[model samples]
Target: MKAILLIGHGSRAKEAKDVFIKVSNGLQERVKSKVYIAFMENATPSIEDAFVSIREDGVRYVDVLPYFLFEGIHIKEDIPEILREMKEKYDVEIEFKRPIEYHELIIDILIDRLKGAGICI
Candidate 1:
């Protein structure tokens, strides 16, 4: 089976974690495939742990979606390295997707946020 692993750069703040979980939950509901969430650090259910759970569920493939905004070290180096190890260890097909880079929708969202803030954008 195939699954989705949404990776978030976890924060020490509870609110950050809460928001990630909320997004994950919403994604889970909208998608037919199994969806799981993990954090890079400062959070529970690390990527490795999530992989173990996914493997246990007999998921043969995983799409690793990084919930990040840029191609930082974490997106370029850290995540790919970890995913390589996980793929070998779990014997599963893993695809590391790009981060949330520039997109027209992002501009729309920014404009909406500015308007919501009464900035008259």
Candidate 2:
């Protein structure tokens, strides 16, 4: 079976982690495939832990969706390296989805936020 692992750069704030989990749960309800959430640091359910859970569910393939906005060091180096290790250790096929970078929808959202803030944009 296939699963989607949403990876977020963990924050020290509890609300950040909670938001990630909430988003993951909402995604689980919307999609047919299994959904899971993991953090890079400062949080529980690390990437490997999530992989173990996925393996337990007999999910052989995982789509790693990084909840990052740009191709930072985590997206460029750290995440891929960790995923490579996880792939070998768990014996699961892993594929990465690109970070959210430069999309028209993002611009639309920014404009909406600005308008909501009474920026008159």
Candidate 3:
């Protein structure tokens, strides 16, 4: 089956990790595909670890979706590098999606957050 690996720059805060997992679960429901979440650092499941779990579950194709907003080093270099290694080790078809860049929908979400913080722009 096709699977999705949601990648996040793991945070030390429990709340951040919790939010990531919640989003992953939601995505799994919406996409109807097996979804796995992993962190680049400071998280329990690393990319390699998550890959192993999904591979064992018979997932042959993986869409490595980055839960990032910017195209920083992590998005550009780190993820690709890790995915290359994982592909070699697991022999799976892996595709990396770029970070969610600026968009009107993102702007709407930002405005909502700002309004909630009592800071109207």
Candidate 4:
């Protein structure tokens, strides 16, 4: 089976965790493939744990999607490094997708947030 792993830069704040959970749930509903959420730090279900879950679910390939806005250190270096290690250890093949900022929909979402906050842009 194929799976999607949504990687987020975990936050200490409860609200941040809530948001990730909600988004992951939403994606799980919309996509045909299985979707799993994992954090880089400051949260539960680390990447390794997520990989284990994916493997347990009989996932043979995964498309890792970083739930980030930009190509920051986590996107460019940290995630890839972890993925490299996971690929070596697991029986599954994995690849990383570009951050959300690479998508045109992000502009629409940003504009919606700005408008909701009464910030005309």
**Candidate 4 Cα misplacement greater than 4 A, ranges:** 119-121
> Best by lDDT, which number?
1
Can you write out model 1's per-residue Cα lDDT over 1-121, one digit (the tens) per residue?
9999999999999999999999999999999899999999999789999999999999999999999999999998998999999999999999898899999999999999999999975
lDDT of 4 by residue, 1-121 (tens): 8999999999999999999999999999999998999999999889999999998888989999999889999898999999999999997899899887766887888899999999978
Q: Output the worst ten-in-a-row residue range by lDDT, candidate 3.
A: 25-34
TM-score of each: 0.96, 0.94, 0.94, 0.90
Higher-TM-score candidate of 2 and 4: 2
- What does candidate 3's lDDT look like per residue over 29-90, in tens digits? 89978889999999979999998898899999999899999999998898899999999999
Best by TM-score: 1
Of the pair 1 and 4, which is ahead by TM-score? 1
| Residue clash pairs of candidate 3 | none
Which candidate do you rate higher for TM-score, 1 or 2? 1
What lDDT score is found at residue 44 in candidate 2? 83
Deviation from native of the Cα of residue 18 in model 1, angstroms: 0.7
- After superposition, candidate 2 runs with Cα above 4 Å error: none
lDDT of 2 by residue, 1-121 (tens): 9999999999999999889889899999999999989999999889999999999999999999999999999999999999999999999999999998889999999999999999975
Name the lDDT value of residue 78 in candidate 3: 85
